[model samples]
Target: MNPTATLVLNNGKSIVIELLPEAAPNTVNSFIFAALNGVYNQHAIERIVSGNWIDMSYSAFHNEKAKYLIPYESQLHPEIEPLPSIAGCVCMGGYDELGLSGCEFFFTLRDCPEHRGVYPVFGRVIEGIDELYRLEKVKTKPITDFPYKNVEINEPIQPEIIRKVEVDLKGFKYDRPIKLPSQVLPKCWAMEYR
Candidate 1:
């Protein structure tokens, strides 16, 4: 089954995501489970780094604390091409010394070509990128005296509230010749030469 759907938030904003189950099965499953179980409901975007992107720390931290560590499922097939971290691109958060990403995730507002091979990108935002851009442009403050220091410290600046994360995998269909959003197609296509 093709993993593709639109995630509608409470603020009337939405994000279309194209999941890569073949590339990152564990990560996809974990994300699906979280979405289906209301784990991402009402979660806020705790961190927002300028030019980098925003981080949904609360959701990730909550998942990690409540759920077991999701195994690292980086791209094993060379055929799966890596894509640029562009605006609306959703990526799994990376572990500090290890390659796996905990629950922390980032939504790219700019084209981050440098992060191609380093991070595991499981999805892309096809809709509501404008809203994400708007959130990325919001003003932020260094959270020094918040109740949750980890949330504050990890996310010194706040971006926008997620409101909720809705998963829709119904009627999603894609052939193997499909190309993912951003510049992932060429990267994956180049794999044929190697």
Candidate 2:
């Protein structure tokens, strides 16, 4: 399928993300379901690691919450061979063998090919990447400090709220229905009499 795109925080400033269904179908489907169900509304970017990515708490604020874990459907398609977790790429959170993380996701700010096999890459920032870059460059100080062991921490940091997630179907243009390339019938199939 031609990947879908979504614009969030529509009040003036917004962030646009292009969902890659072919690369990460499960992750894209989950994100779409969450958006349609109002899961992203009021959700905060809870965690931000400088030069790493921004992680948002999706299930925490949602009414139903993400109760079940979708299997890790990473870069399986040959078309998306060796997907790279580059800057602006949205990826799924990792979990233990139990499979628990529901709402957490990260957006890469640099090419981290090391994470290709470890993380499921689902989407990319087609627009508003400048805003994301700004957020990543923000100066963050630890909220707490412990002298002896040198333990530092921070919390309650507000990045940016996703006011709403809306899919712009008008932006996508797929020439054909999503199917395996092998399943595509030849053009001559329509001229049976020939």
Candidate 3:
């Protein structure tokens, strides 16, 4: 049976995600491991573009802020039929050159055609999408003083938090994902985003 992860927010609201192991084996593995290990505890909801996505598992906002790299599953796994970035779908986040962030994830707010062939859709919301919608409507501001065109800061002004994530393995042994050769992010990220 597919595992389901319930993320309880600081406000007591929860978001339940149905993990698709077959669609994204390693991505799902990484998520289950991270959740069970308390990686998402007190994690910040870093970015939010109203009507776009909720950047939930960004390393930039994680407690460790560690850039744990993993192979981009969508590019490597061609056997599985690719899924669309429809509303409530969850996806891994990363650049093509470096590979996908082992734990970076975002929730699609609507049908995102542009995200196709880029991020792998790994999970779907089974319940409490309204909890995410509440965060979506939050007022956000830029992370930096410089107004760079590429840098559209959607940092929540009131600081949204993920209190905890509990997952039901349901007899599935979700091992840790095979980490990439490197764990650190590229130099470019250090240059600007840090």
Winning candidate number (lDDT): 3
lDDT of 3 at 122: 88
Tens digit of per-residue lDDT, candidate 2, span 1-194: 44555546524567778788777765676676666667677665555667777766423343444434554553234455536899889887655343323345678878888878567787888788887776776566554322224322222354566777786545554331222223322221222312
Best to worst by lDDT, what's the order? 3, 2, 1
Q: How high is each candidate's TM-score?
A: 0.68, 0.70, 0.89
Stronger candidate by lDDT (1 vs 2):
2
Model 3 RMSD in Å is: 2.6
Among these predictions, the greatest TM-score belongs to 3
| Each model's backbone clash number | 1, 0, 0
lDDT of 3 by residue, 1-194 (tens): 79999989999999999999998888898888777777788987887888888888444343453457778776568777768889999998876687877777899999998877678888999999998889888889866642334645578999899999999999768777877886547443343443
Q: List per-prediction Cα lDDT, in the order shown.
A: 0.58, 0.59, 0.79
Candidate 1 TM-score, true structure as reference: 0.68
Model 2 segments beyond 4 Å from truth? Answer: 1-3, 74-82, 100-102, 139-159, 169-194
